[model samples]
Target: MSWLVTGGAGYIGAHVVRALVDDGESVVVYDDLSTGSAERIPEGVPLVVGSVLDRSALDAAIRDNAVTGVVHIAAKKQVGESVEQPLHYYRENVTGLQTLLEAMASAGVGRLVFSSSAAVYGMPDVDLVTEDTPCLPMSPYGETKLVGEWLIAAAARAHGIRAASLRYFNVAGAAAPELSDSGVFNLIPMVFERLEAGEAPRVFGDDYATPDGTCVRDYIHVADIASAHLAAARRLADFPEGTALTPSTSDAGRAARSGRWSTASSRSPAGRTSAGHEPSVTRQVSLADRARELLGWSARHDLDDMIESAWQGWRRRHG
Candidate 1:
């Protein structure tokens, strides 16, 4: 059965489509071309021009493509914009996901890989965040993601749908120049924008409790994100029939921080080491560990690799 990838023409979605295709899986691109570019879609893949909000379009695509699974990557994801336009974010992200879930249930598409976010854990106070961390989202965008996860979990329990929600941290870099993220909403691109204008990238709130007074984030490569989707899809497909996949910490722990961030502070050149904050005996191991154990997945790229690859893409577009 083929996979229906919503928002397949977008930056991250396009990467996911490519990864699925490379793995010999049949894929159909479903996108509305709102913030997504049609040109990002590869040859030999069927592109269905539609939105998740369009129930008829979603139904038609799933039925026509004989889709057995869905990799949902479509959603409004701007933190600041989500605050200003909370209603709009809810309608597009949460409501649209509900529509898609309904269409899936009707069409008998039982497997899903939902694109979630680290934003779900707003300003985490823990030394290491995991899947079971407290979810106190700070913005509408984050709330939408958490709600989406809840919806997926509920749907899975009620309808026997096998699903996985991948809570991605900061995603950066690209597999190719053309596939690089064009949006400036993310940190890497934001930095690129400042540098292109001959200005230093601003580090907000240097007085925070972090080691260097700057925030530390677990940045994963977009390519790694794509592979994680494939891994989750395969795991779901392999599950026994009549079994509903619960919200496993396996999917939630996909993007754990493997290393410390380097900073310009006097405390240490390379901030606190992973050894500094040892894993608690009572607390669970990292999400990355769970991912490796359950899905055979691990992130191979580091921060420097991500920055260098992103810089190449930036120069290709803005130079």
Candidate 2:
């Protein structure tokens, strides 16, 4: 059974592709090359260059590859950018996904694995978020992800497509330095950008419920996310109606930042004080055990491992 991986040349998507390949699955990569680099794709895997919004392209890709499943990862994922350009976000993320779904249905692709996000929960007051958590997205990017989930679930119910939606949080680290994320939208890369400019990593607000008054963000290894995709893909036959899973580490958000500054401080001249305070405990929003019980998945790397890998990748690409 061949799998068509949309956005497979991008950071996380490439890792997912590698993981599936490592596990001996036949894989095809579909990417637009907008943010995705063709070099990231593995040799011998077919690369389909097109937007997810292009129905004809998707059909051709699926048909050419004899694809039976899809791992949809293409999207515009910037929170601030989404706020400034909501329509673009909707058109690309929402409409692009709709087009893909329509193509999949037409092609008789019965299995789907959708790459979703933690942003769908917005700013939840809960200590932990489960699959059942109410989704009130604050940004257009998050809204698009939530809507994508709704679309996948609807397709699953009506079209008999087995699917999985993984709402992963603050993804850091890489399988290799070359596979590291180049964009600075994420916290680890954003901090690297600030350090490159000789500026301190800024903390927006500190008067929150956390011990150090910072918002929480659960960090996960990109490899673990890839493995979870494999797990969900393997178990898709079990979930006939499609399901949602949250792949997360135990330490999240503000807790991830404040608790692990020491790990980052070891290499930076700005040190632990760069964040403006010594490491302190903070409230964590755990992604509940749904993924564990169902997909048999859990995060493998720790915060130190995450920081170290990200730093190495940043230096390799930028320095």
TM-score of each: 0.86, 0.90
Model 2 alpha-carbon drift over 4 Å, by segment: 241-255, 258-284
Model 2 lDDT tens row, 1-319:
7999999999999999999999999999999999999999989999999999899999999999999999999999988899999999999999999999999999889999899987887777777776677888888999999999888888887888888888887788898998999898787887777677766666655655766667566778888889989998999878745454434333333237443342364434443333355343244366647778888877777777777898899989987
Question: Candidate 2, overall lDDT?
Answer: 0.81
Q: Where's the lowest-lDDT run of ten residues in candidate 1? A: 257-266
Best by lDDT: 2
Q: lDDT score, residue 304, model 2?
A: 71
The candidate that wins on TM-score is 2
| lDDT of every predicted structure (CA atoms) | 0.77, 0.81
**Tens-digit lDDT track of model 1 for 22-100:** 9999999999988999888889999999989999999999999899999999998899899999999999999999999
* Candidate 2 TM-score over all chains jointly: 0.90
